[model samples]
Target: MTATARLALTATLCAFAAPALAQEITINSFGGAYEEAHRKCVIDPFTAETGAKVNIVTAYSADAFAQLRAQKDAPQYDVIHFSGGQEIVGASEGLLLPVTEEMVPSLADLYDFAKAGVANGEGPAYQIAAVGLVVAADKVPSEPTKWADLMKPEYAEHLVLTNITNGYGMIGLLMLNQIAGGSGDDIQPGLDAVSQLLDAGAVVVSTSPEIQAEFAQNDAWIAPYASDYAFTLKKAGLDVKFIQGEEGTPASFITANLVAGRDNVELASKFIDKSLSPDAQACFSEALRYTPTNSKTVLTDEVAADVVYGADAAKGLMRFDPRVIEANRSAWTEAFAKTIAR
Candidate 1:
């Protein structure tokens, strides 16, 4: 065809492509600084790379699950991000799609355990948040040296806890319970331990900002929380200390789940792939202080030294089986709510 004919054909194709290109994929992400890091490190670059518009919707993991169940027949979100093992329950109920090496080739690039979503058979593990205890140096008379330190006479009523409905809250329960000689099947010991604190007036906080606020006012002395949040609290100028827990910390990973029936599978898959990519992983680790699951994303010595990094470091952390946690989470939450009701 002549040059003018070729130009006319290209223009027609471009006109037809406009609508599809204009299509947007919605993602439910964690709000606050985590969301900001995701927007900067993952969403922004993905948009710049593919010209795809991504809309970010924020919800806590449990709330996101509830929303998914309510919108089951007519789903609203394209990709759902979850911490802890909510993905397992979502996957079993067919609310989420499977994420395997095929969906994200970078699956091979992540740690072996990270390849599976908390062993829950859900989507890919994009990032990991190490759950542990954070102590307020100024409030506590002495440094908290172990997980059992919260139950000590000096720290009663000063403990800040995340509630059961939240992911960190669940992890805190499991960690303390395990330290008190309980397993995933029994969170009673954990509850009993924290119940003492609650009885003495320990504060229960559901969000990172809430934890920080409670600490800033010297109302809370210590909290069982993620390592990232400890750094976040410190950076915000709280005189705090992050304890690695004499009994190690639990790993509550953030996973990327595809909505069971979404129109933008290709786009969504691309976004997930990019989220686990080296660049995005590094950005999240450095900026948000999350533990990177992508093995290929090497961190500088300085950054790695401060946070959980590498296969050895990650393995050193504690992990609850997602299936076990899934089975007992509902019951545990009810018991925990009652324990802290005082």
Candidate 2:
């Protein structure tokens, strides 16, 4: 061949050998430490394995759901995480796609409780955060074993109660209501109990940061919060102890759902599947103290002790229906406000 012809042949071969661009998908993750752990545990490993790029949008559960509603015609996120049970409403309104075992093979490996919402056309829970009591070990006179213990007169003025607008706070309040003979349809009993506590001097906080501040600055002795937050408090040098109220620990299921109408549903499924893998689950458990949803995920004895590990342990967790919670949320919030105001 002539020199020019040979150069032309080399250029054609180079063009044929060029790599295709990596697939990219956008996902919304919670902010702060949870997102940091998610990056290390799920996103990094997913990229390393699949060669797909994940673009993150940091919005908490309620805000993310609102964004989904607003963008229904032009979906932005491929996958969205909800720690606040927004998936129920999202799935109902057709904002989210139904996740199945066929799409995400690891769905079969999740705990039964973790798969509770899949039949409702929602996503499977990737991790569990048990809502329980976190007490300042040095301040509380004794370790609280049940939800009613918070009502003890001695806890007055040193207790921090979360507002119902927050997910953790919502679960905490529902659990209190359950023990106080109030059902989801009837929150009056719960409100009355909270009013009694408020009358006795317990303070109400609306956000996690505020709760942390109450603990760090105000000598708050006890609070109804999640197990994972106990670790956060401990990391901040507070001597805290997590107690799963003997009545039952309410679970906060963190779910990752596919956004409806997204072009990258296949890629999004892979991302969600990666989160349910034993390795990723274990990473989340260690980093954020979130309980692994994947049944196969193994943990060290220390980590197991901290989370709600194993099938039997998971069976004992209290799971409120997200549908019921969403339905009653508005009226409950109003009643809560009125009660607290008194």
TM-score of each: 0.80, 0.89
- Candidate 1 per-residue lDDT, tens place, 104-178, comes to 788778887776553344777778888777878777778887788878876777878899778778878888888
lDDT for each residue of candidate 2 in 106-158, tens digit (9 for 90 to 100): 99999887887786768889999998899999887777889999889999789
Off by over 4 Å in 2: 1-22
Clashes of 1: 0
The residue pairs in collision within model 1 are: none
**What are the runs in model 1 whose C-alpha is more than 4 Å off?**
1-23, 70-74, 117-121, 137-145, 152-158, 196-210, 219-221, 321-331
